[model samples]
Target: MIPAAVDAARAALADPAAVAARWRADHDGPVIAHLPYDVPAELILAAGALPVAVFPPGAEQAQAHLQGWICSPARRFLAAARQGELAWADGLVIPQICDTMRGLKGLWQFLQEPAFLESYNLPRISRASARPYFASELSRLRDRIQGFTGRTADDGRLRAAIALCNAVRERTALLFQRRVLGQISNLDYYTLVRASYVLPPEEMLALLGGMDVEDAAVSKPPAVPVVVSGQLMEPLAVAGLLDQCGLSVVGDDLVDGERAWRTVAEGGDPLAALAERTLNAPPCAVKNGPVTRETYLAALVAERGAQGVIFLHFRNCEMENLGYPGTRDHLERLGIPTLYLETQWGTAAAGAVVTRLEAFREMLEGC
Candidate 1:
């Protein structure tokens, strides 16, 4: 018999539209689109709206919508939005997470849709100046949300929203923790976690709560656990490749991965808590902090019990590419092996990545 959690997750995956429909029934508020790796989810929820992550699908018609653009990840996300795959949204929230995403905002702005639109900017680097910048950006976002929704997000209201969101996020984190502890396989975890992007957080949270896999035994010992970092355009391909290479990806710092958890900081100030958590949360190539990319990488490796770190940078992502050498050096200093793979934002390079990953696995085993 299939595990109850897996079965529940599969049901959600089979009819994501039904899930969206259910959310629409409960909440009459506008839907908000959150860009990848941005802090839009928390803000959307705080605004008393449903937060939906937009991504491109693999259908042929979807491809046609994005004909000129190479099959990049951004193109795929746009295609999905154009093809009605994300039609359930009442509005879209675009974040200035990176250059590609910034360009996407302009493209989306002129689409002439009556759907409400909002844009947010999160600090790229976690430096001395980043915290204040994030706080200000978040405050501006709160004002916009209030103006758009005509709702006041006072201390009491923000706290209630934060508590609900935190409950949902904590459940999600426990699910990932179960998988990371080797009680579940990467495939199973990916199936469930990826489904969360398409489903409403409440529904996803309930599904996770129904999961009873905590005591399940692993079929095999987890090989060196590794935390996947950087842009993950195609998580299905990345997770599949990692599994084939015999490395168990216990956790990740990616937006689409374990980092989606909502952080609830104490005090009456929700914006401050949100800003602090966004900066302190897992290592992202775009964050600004005194700690270099290498420091973040090393910390993730140790925290995740990962013997090695995989810096998965997308081709033409200059920020990550430029920081590669320093990141590698930092990992080496901590005696953590590192494998850096650069690729275009599609699964076309899966075969090659698998080969390199297998070699890396062997190298790790020999250590």
Candidate 2:
């Protein structure tokens, strides 16, 4: 049996809008919505509000509002807001990552005209000036949150929020470590992580703290271990499919997965600490940090004893596809097998994806 806490998290993820609505109805503070990758969630929490990570909605819903070729994530977010799936959120924060993402603020304004919509200028290149620039951007974001919530996210509150989120991240790291050890199944592992995106920190920590991985792993079968490097294991059923194919996802270099939690904010100044944490966090295709994505993926594979790497990318995601060739070549040169799986928003676990995974698993077993 899944722990009650984990089960609760799964339930919350199933209907995130309902969860956000309930939070807004119950809390005195506003509910803040943000996309994945960057955007300091601590500022939202510090404002005494719920920080809800808005996942992409149905692709078809976004077709009328955006070009069919626009990345599904960007399209879906716009559709969700217009369709009222995100109506409960008091405001939305969009970080400037790519041209498509940068244009979202204008699209949102022209299409939805939300009461409070703000954008943060997240630096793509990491340099000496990046930290200070990001810190200033975070300060601007804090002001935006204050404007929406009518409550200042003062330093003390920001510190408390940082400590709370940092604690949750710490516990989540432990959870993933347990997953790596075969103490949790892929479905449960990702489900618990997805739960963090919806559930408040205190509640998520409670569930994570109560997990008994020793019991959970008792009946799980051993499988070939591999690492997934991509945006996310979307539609989540993909995780279960991997398990069925005898592949254990031991680690990931996903923007929304392991990368988001690997760093903790430090130092005295909360904003500066957050900026440093953002600049220092694991390098992704979206950010030009000191470490390259290929290097990071290679290190993760070695650390986890992964025999192969699965490069999972959302179809039409320019940024994800742009960095793929080099990373693939790097892994191949090191004699590490790799597979490229391009997925659309709703076609996850489709026959083609399953076929590829099955073949990859067979090849790994033969080797």
Candidate 3:
């Protein structure tokens, strides 16, 4: 059974805007909004502002703003702003990581002027020059954030924030290992991880620390250990299907999953640390800008002792489309079974997805 603390964390994730509203009321915070991917939240936290993720349930009335195969995440963020779900947000930080995100930033800037928005230029390649450029970007962002929040990003404060965040990741890593062993449900584990994006890390850390999970491994009737790679796992029914199939996600290369928590900021210089972690963290399909994800994914599969890999991509994501073929080939070459599927935030097409998972499981079992 998942602990009450974890249940509370899941509840907070379900209604993050409400939680942010409460935080603002209590802390006098200017909440900063960003997607679930890698953007330094420590900077915002160090600046005394709350960093909440812009994850609206669905993109209702957002089609008027976004068009031509725009991903649901972009549409949902716009819809949240237009529909007042993000009224608590004082600013939005859109990262330059994908086409959909870039379009979202352009549209958001054009539509809502006089709103403090920053189009963070996250690098495509982690080259020698990328570190300096990323550090400069972080400095500029820190300046704007200080000016907006009337707080200083002292080395002392930023380091404290980084320490807090790193501790949060360390605690989460424990839960993730338990999840792999089936000591915690995938739904519960993901709910806790997803909540970390929105909830105050200190508060989320306290909740995670309260989880009294047993150490015993609880395997289902039969299953294959699989690594799930994706930008974000949403609608969560996809994870539910994995649980149903008894396929344990031993590891992942998802932007929002292990990728975010596994790599924490390091160094005495907080800005440089954030930039370095951004560039050094798990390579994503878009962020790496090449075929690096294939090698990265293969390494994850082998390290996790996964029998297969499941590549989950948002429907209109170009980065994943470009990298999927090579990644599939790489795993196949290693004799690792794989499944690639396009998923949307709204529906799992439960029957279709579950049927596919069942068939995949059968294949892995035969192997």
Candidate 4:
């Protein structure tokens, strides 16, 4: 039986708009929409606003404002704002993850001009200076959120929010461990992780912790074990395709996957903790960190016992493109077969992707 918490999470991902609608019916304040990767959601919660994730799914509407080429996610999110899909969002926070996201922040402000908007600039490196810079950014963000919400986030409230978020992170990490042991299906695992983006940390923690955690080998041994890397699991269609194609995702480097949940905050200032956890989590395409991405990917591959790596990057994503050649070369030099899939938000070529994934599975099996 599916856990109730999982059910709630699934409901959130199924229709984030509906979740916001429900929050409106229940709560007394506006919702602060948070984009993916890194936005300190605790501050939003402390501001008396419901912090929700905004993942635009396509570029159809966004293309009108953008020229050249734009990544599917960045374009889609802007499209959501332009199309009134995110009209319920009282404010929006855009974290600086890459050039595409930076452009998105500008376009969102210039074109759509939401009532509340803040571009959170993030540091690309995890140097000693990054911590203070990030913490100050968080402080500034907190002030912006306060201005939007008209509520003060005292230290007590901020700490409370931090504790709640940390609990959710810890629970997600445990669920990830269970998934690594084959207790969870790649699709189920992906669904669970996607749920976290939309649901509040309190509810996510409940859902993640309430799982039965059976010994069901969703992906049996001898199935092709592979690690999937991407900006975010934009369309979970890939996980379903991988499952159908006989590929089991032993690990992932996606923003919503291992990157979001693997790290937890410890003692000290809440802002410092948030900054540290953000920097210490899995290596993102934009953030190289102290340890090289190749080293990080190698460790993940070894730890997960993966036979191959599948990099499913979205179309026109600059940061992912920057790191792709290096990742592919590193993995290939080590004799690990790597498949790079360039995807769009829509399913125009989904059948072709499935066929290619099936062939890749055959190759992994042969190896």
By lDDT, who's the top model here?
2
**RMSD, one per candidate, in order:** 3.2, 1.8, 2.1, 2.1
Candidate 2: regions farther than 4 A off: 1-3, 56-58, 212-217
Ranking under TM-score, best-scoring first?
Answer: 2, 3, 4, 1
lDDT score, candidate 2, position 28: 89
Predicted structure 1, TM vs. truth: 0.86
User: What is candidate 1's local distance difference test score?
Assistant: 0.68
Candidate 4 residue lDDT tens string, 274-367: 7887777667787866588777777788988898889888888878888889888998898888898998764436798888998998888888
Off by over 4 Å in 4: 3-7, 57-59, 214-222
Give lDDT per model, in order: 0.68, 0.80, 0.79, 0.78
Estimate TM-scores for all models.
0.86, 0.94, 0.94, 0.93
Question: How well is each residue in 189-243 modelled by candidate 3, as lDDT tens digits?
Answer: 7777888888888788778775544745575455579999888877666887888
Ranking by lDDT: 2, 3, 4, 1
Instruction: Highest TM-score: give the candidate number.
Output: 2
User: After superposition on all CA atoms, how large is the RMSD of candidate 2?
Assistant: 1.8
Residue range with the least summed lDDT across 10 consecutive positions in model 2? 210-219
List where candidate 1 sits over 4 angstroms from the true fold: 1-4, 7-16, 59-71, 112-114, 127-129, 210-214, 333-335, 343-348
